[model samples]
Target: MAFRSFGSVDLSPSECYDMLVNVVTPRPIALVSTVSADGMQNLAPFSYFQLGGTSPPSLMISPTLSPEGTEKDTLVNVSATREFVVNIVTREMVEEMNITSVRVGPTEDEWKLACFTPIASDIVRPPRVAESPVHLECTVFKIIRHGDGPSASNYVIGEVVRFHVDDAMLEGQMMLAEKLHTVGRLGGDNYIDTGVPERFRLARPSTPLSRQ
Candidate 1:
């Protein structure tokens, strides 16, 4: 089999981004909510997200700079307030979540645009998306900037202070994946639905193969 390789240095920012989003394969979406210093709400979705750590309960979401070198409202809000809420995106909320991603002014409220019910967060100024089953109330731990200009990422490391879980989605201490109906991002105009039929479990090996 022949595989083509492209040099990173030769690719433009947009080309690199296109290659990345196409190859990453179903990245989990973080529907992040934040509030400006003036108390204006901002909501946005970022697929460049992941669990940073388990012990401290941290999440990392990377928001990239626009083509015109402008910062996103979510980044600006979180930077000023150092607080945000990460709402997990499920299949049912996908359409509304996408609506929140539309480019808008700093003062525009995405919660109203998406028609999502926002519940007052107990710890953070940003409200929790009532439509989401899991909400993580977080305070910014650190902000790491990579590169400069368009498509540059600002990695926001958030330490979760509180968690809001839908009681109905829980089975004792565990929240089953089947109940969540989580959706993930693929390439352009594509999304992955994590249905039970598409899932399988594999047990981990007790010892390394090299040791055996």
Candidate 2:
């Protein structure tokens, strides 16, 4: 007979979060910055973020409402300005990113608190992180709101109009994840980075799958 793990394990919320954090291998964390309606800035980190792009080159950041169904600062700002920047989180600035994760008043400058420099962008009033190895300047494409549910979160999508990168962070035409040392958010306050571990890649189809 084959043995099973779930058979003896309880899948409670806390346990599930712990397992997901530790077992997801690694997930890219997005340290997003946005400006509120009154011209105040807000910074927050989200693990529910990832690339949903190409063509127009888009990105997605989700700001989950609390149990009371109130929008987060990031979500509110993005909706108003229709613009924001998605800065990649790296191991070197992991501590700063964590500080930005704190939920505070819109007037509080997370950048000042975290000691990150702000650089002007071509198309957006909001700024990008000078310390980040890569920055994506985006204009809001759309926002999908969710009704009250177990895990409902506001999904904000943006079109990338600009991209910046540090020359040292790239190897030839490829991004060396190990060298970039990007960090990912785990369940709670925990995070992990590229361990310089073994890796592999699969072949890509030259033609669109839909045409095949």
TM-score of each: 0.90, 0.78
Specify the highest-TM-score model's number. 1
User: Lowest-lDDT window of 10 residues in candidate 1?
Assistant: 203-212
* Residue 207 CA displacement from its true place in model 1, Å: 53
Model 2, position 109: C-alpha lDDT score: 76
lDDT accuracy of residue 76 in candidate 2 = 83
Candidate 2 minimal-lDDT segment of 10 residues:
203-212
Give the runs in model 2 whose Cα sits over 4 Å from its true position: 1-25, 149-151, 171-178, 195-212
The alpha-carbon RMSD values of the candidates against the true structure, listed in the order shown, are 11.3, 11.3
Model 2: per-residue Cα lDDT over 1-212, one tens digit each: 99557731478645655766677756788888788888887777778777786988988888877545667778889999998988988777877777776556666677987799988878887888888889888999999977564346688988999988888867776776566777765545556666543232212222222110
What value does the lDDT take at residue 167 in candidate 1?
92
- Residue 68, candidate 1: alpha-carbon lDDT: 79
Assess each prediction's global lDDT (C-alpha) against the native: 0.86, 0.75
Q: After superposition, how far is residue 192 of candidate 2 from its true place, in Å?
A: 1.4
